[model samples]
Target: MANVLVCIKRVPDLGGEIRLTADAMGVDDSSLGHTVSPHEEAAVELAIQTAKDTGGEATVLTLGSEDAVEQLRNALALGCTGAVLVEADAAAYGPADVAAAVADVVRDHEAAGTSYDLVLVGNDASDTGDFQVGVRLSYLLDRPVVAGVSTLSVDGGEVTARGGSPDGGTEVYQVALPAVLTVMEGGVEPRYPSIPGRMKAKKIAIDRVTPTGEPQGSGRRRLTLPPAQPSQVTVLGEGPEAAGAVVDLLESLGVTR
Candidate 1:
């Protein structure tokens, strides 16, 4: 049976306005809610579905603070068979470091007689926007890597990953087993955890591991929030005169013939 590993990140909910920290080095999540990154949520769903289809095992992994276990448990509630937490301060590590740490966990698990057949990750973390983790982890694991994958399936030890092309067509890649894929959102709708699922997840033990080595270096100086876009409201004439202005605006916007 195929063993799939889906990596997730705990990030501030992006549904609200985002603000930077005092030093502008990170997000000001103090006033925001937290959840798994949207793309990673899809990855988790894909992993669970694949495992269910193949009669395999789906494991969720995360690298973050102890509190991040909440995110891991959320995956369990969604039907992952197991969970792992590489306990660390996510903000202190860069993409390379996170990749290395995750690679270490995969190796350890494999050595312990659980070799993963597939590894799924989000295309990029919501907060950091770093897109290198999946590729770096694949390189470290000596496996084929597919990024921006929207759909995937496994057959006879092969994985078919489909993604979008610039020309609006689909790009499909068939790779051997034990591959890595960076999943994007919109491939499938993530299911909500039921009350019973949450209760079971709360009882599941999360395997926690400490990172083996220090971060090599992030090469990041600081974060800068984008400036807000300027907006203006034009005053058209009152009553009937406004209709002509509205029509003119619609035509200018190419909304009218």
Candidate 2:
């Protein structure tokens, strides 16, 4: 039996009008439309493509409030076999706490005889972009993890992943089964859900699990936008003299001369 689990998150649409309240703590989600986080979106696409390729089942899991059901439908519409929703509010936990919650979910699944051959997650959340969840989750689950995966494939109980490094190069890795992978954005292009798929996914049932940890980080500090940089102005000079002045100005500004 081939089983796969994909973890996803519902995030506010950055393109839409997003406002920071006076408190600067949370987002004004009143008029904000929500979608899967970009990294998570890519994970879903990879999950769907993997399922199609291997002819296996894919399950998506998320932890959110009641409204998070929409995220499940979104994943199902992308062709997941099932969805699991860990019933927690939006501000439920910090990264550490969320990792614990996911560990509990994995334990519950294991106890219930639901085993997974592979677990997938996004590289990081859009808001925090800590890039720690997948690594933490792997440690919690006692599984090997490969982060920053741009290409992934499974064959005969072995998995091969190609990840991009900082120096514009790709590294290939091979690992055994029961591993966790965090996918990057350029791994694969996501497919649009068909109308029929959307309708079917809407009616799909989501299993709700009560996570162990009470919402952590709810009392944490709020969000604050970083100071914006001023636009650049170019000063023109005459030939070599102008170039020397430009170099001097760049050196004074601590920029490469």
Candidate 3:
């Protein structure tokens, strides 16, 4: 049976005002409620759907404090076969650090003889928005990486994918298996957890494993808000004189014609 690993994160709700530790390196999880990153959720759903199609199991992994288990459970509810938690006392890591930790987790799984056919992660996490994790993981795994994928299909050891383009067009590519895929949101709407799914997920067992590697980037930094700016008002021109005034105002504002 094909095996897949879906990576996810527990991030602060966007609606809430998030305050990072003074270090600015880590989030202040103590005061924030957690929710799954939307892009990661889409990746998980795609993994689950792919598993259903390809005949295998989708395993979920996350690295954070114990509270992150909540988001893992949410993944379980979404039909993942099982969950693994990489525990850390103090949640702190930059993109590079987090990527290293994640690579270690994948290596652990590989060493245990539980190699996956594919590793799936979001194009970008919601918090830091660093989009390098999947590519780094692909490098660590020594596998081909297809990123910004919005659609995916696997068949007979070959895969096909589509991604957004800088030219405002869609680009598609085909690659071999054992690849890392960074799924972009809007490929598919993530399935909502139903009552039955939640019930089953709550009962599903989650295995805890000791996380590998030291936490990186623990140095503290200050929190500063952006400078506020006054709002601009648009005044409609009524005639030639009004239009000339508007032109003069635009020139004053340094807006070139």
Candidate 4:
């Protein structure tokens, strides 16, 4: 089993209608629930599986408010062995800021005489859709990074990854361990947490850490939602009386005259 560290973000559950904030800097998440993206869910599943395969442990980490623990616990319930919380306002941290923060944690682990063989992150951010964190983190830690990965397996000191290419083909890579990877969804199906797992996760302790410096900030101006696509549904008629109308409608379309 490989010692794995998987980073995740807490994002608004965008399943329902979205309402933008007055400043347009973000959505009105005050009333919205929170969860991780499907991509991160898969990453979590992969992390646990990788650790189990290599005889190591999987750790889930996040930089967010106190409530973000809900998501961490969700991963724990799914089988992560440990969890870490970097207490900070996630909305206030930009890609570069959080990347540095994660790097700090990695260094801390090394200084404590422990190290992880793999670091995983969602290929794209859930709320912001930014694809910069994984690359930045790997740079800060001076590790090779593979992005947009859909599947991966760890064997001894090397990890093999597969992803999609621009030409609708598959791109495969075999990189050494102590690597960073950004995972995308679709290659594997995430498993649900069992009742026993959930109960066990609730009892495990989550390690907490705080940011050491102020965020450098971002130049992002605003967020804009695309215009809604127009759609319409027409009902021809109902029951027995609709047959003639349906035939007439088809004839109007030149299908059945």
Task: After superposing candidate 2 on the true structure, give the runs of residues whose Cα lies further than 4 Å from its correct spot.
Answer: 16-18, 227-257
lDDT of each: 0.91, 0.83, 0.82, 0.92
Return the lDDT, model 3, position 115: 82
Could you arrange the candidates by lDDT from highest to lowest? 4, 1, 2, 3
| Model 4 residue 222 lDDT score | 90
Q: Where does candidate 1 have its weakest 10-residue lDDT segment?
A: 225-234
lDDT measured at residue 77 in model 3 versus the true structure, 0 to 100: 86
Let me know the TM-score candidate 2 reaches against the reference structure: 0.84
State each model's C-alpha RMSD to the native. 2.5, 5.4, 5.1, 3.0
Reference-based lDDT, residue 158, model 1: 95
lDDT of 3 by residue, 114-199 (tens): 88888999999887678898998888879999999888888879778889999989999889888899998888899998889889
Better of 1 and 2 by TM-score: 1
How close is every model to the real structure, measured as TM-score? 0.92, 0.84, 0.82, 0.89
**Which candidate model has the greater TM-score, 2 or 3?**
2
As a TM-score, model 1 comes out at 0.92
Clash pairs for candidate 2: none
**Predicted structure 3: lDDT:** 0.82
**Higher-lDDT candidate among 2 and 3?**
2
